[model samples]
Target: RKLPGAAGAADEGAADAIRELEEQLEQATQSLRAREEESKAAEKRGQALNSKLRRAQAALAQARAEARRHAEAGAHQDQELRDQVASLSSELDRARRKLKRAGKRHEEDKADKAARKELQEDFERRGTELYKMNDKLREAVERADLLGKALAMQADEVEQLRKHVGEADEWRAKCDRLSMAEAAAAVG
Candidate 1:
């Protein structure tokens, strides 16, 4: 009497665990999908960033060219001012001094341009490293997707086994009850 009920409870517990595993497998699959989407989005971002970086490099080159032209114009202006100072002798030595300062500023601008070029090279190197990192991340996501599929399959197998066990337990209980009923009827 009570033995059959105890057996049924044990079977129910096993069935419940199998159900829980199935639910967990579903959640894992959803998470794997999310990771795959994130990987794709990361790839898109890297591409966009690379495109923008290329445009920025082109703009920097244009700016360097404009700066070179401006420096050349300033040098021509300095020469003209120097000739005027020579003719005017002492009236505008200050103008000649200003022209010298402008030349020094052009030297500083050359140094700045060199530094900017170095920075651009560094940025390109860093971008390449970032792309490699993203590749590894995408690979990790793919592996996780495979693992989720395997886990889902295993969970399904467990669920099927649980169902079969539950059916067998039910049939055993029914047979026991039927035999007991028949024995009691014969005794009566």
Candidate 2:
């Protein structure tokens, strides 16, 4: 009876050990499955990050290219502006020369106008003097004509007086002859 009871007790202990090992194995399997799901989630996140990094790199390259293009265009525009400034400066110089010439011409014209005015005044003065001289000459001619008429009248009066004197002398001679004849008759 003692031997059979000991064998039955050993058999019960062995059955309990087997049940504990199976429970431990099931827990280990569940832990392993949870770890696999976590690893797959981490791998998907890494792939998404890689895709974003590639896109960012491409955007940076395109931005650099655009900046270079803008710089080249700005340089060309600066050169064009310099050329325009030079052209404008040349035109300004030409305009200044033309203005200087015009100013000199204006001064010459003013001088000519002053000379013409002086000549006109001299001509007017000479004309006035000539008119006065002509008036004086006309008056002198009128006086000469009057003097000539008076001299002609005086000559005619002198000739008439001489003829009357000649007649008086003839009469005086005839009277003397008659007296002499009367004296001679008385004596006879």
Candidate 3:
């Protein structure tokens, strides 16, 4: 009876050891599967970050290109505006000088106005005197025309008187001849 009891106790101890070894193997398998899942998640996160970095770099390059083009255009417009301002400033200066000269001339003309007025009045007075002289000369020419007509009539009267004198002389000579003839007849 004692030998059988000892043999039975030994068999029970060996069964307990086999059960403990199986539990240990199961725990190790569960731990290895959880580590594999964590590694896969880390790889996916890295891939997503790389894609975002590429997109950001492309956006930055595009923005730089646009900025450069705007700066160049702005510079060109600024230069054009500056040139226009310079041209307008020069024109304004020229206009101002011309106005100043004109103002000086106007002041000089105003100062001489009294002398100019006196000369104008004298010229008008002389013109009136000359007009009266011209009227007198016209009247003298009319009187000369009348006198010339009277002289022509006097010359015609003188010519008629000379013809009458010649006729009288002829008659006187005939009378003298007749008287002499009569005296000779009486003597005979």
Question: Would you list the C-alpha lDDT of every candidate in the order shown?
Answer: 0.55, 0.52, 0.52
**Candidates by TM-score, descending order:** 2, 1, 3
Off by over 4 Å in 3: 1-107
TM-score of each: 0.40, 0.43, 0.39
lDDT of 2 by residue, 1-188 (tens): 23368797876776666565555545544554554455455445545545554554455455545545555545555565456556655654555566567787675555555545654565565556545555554554454455445445544544444444444444445434444443443343
Off by more than 4 A, model 2:
1-4, 91-188
Task: Please give, for residues 125-179, the per-residue lDDT of candidate 1 as tens digits.
Answer: 6556556655554555555455555555545554554555455455545545655
How many clashing pairs does model 1 include?
0
lDDT for position 31 in model 3 = 48
Task: Write the residue-wise lDDT of candidate 3 on 1-188 in tens digits.
Answer: 22368787776765566465445444544543454454445445445544544554455455445445555545555565456556655654565567567787565555445445654565566556546555554554554455455545544554554455455445445544544554444343
Cand. 2 TM to true fold: 0.43
Candidate 2 accuracy as lDDT = 0.52
For every model in order, what is the number of clashing pairs? 0, 0, 0
Clashing pairs in 1: none
CA lDDT, candidate 3, residue 60: 46
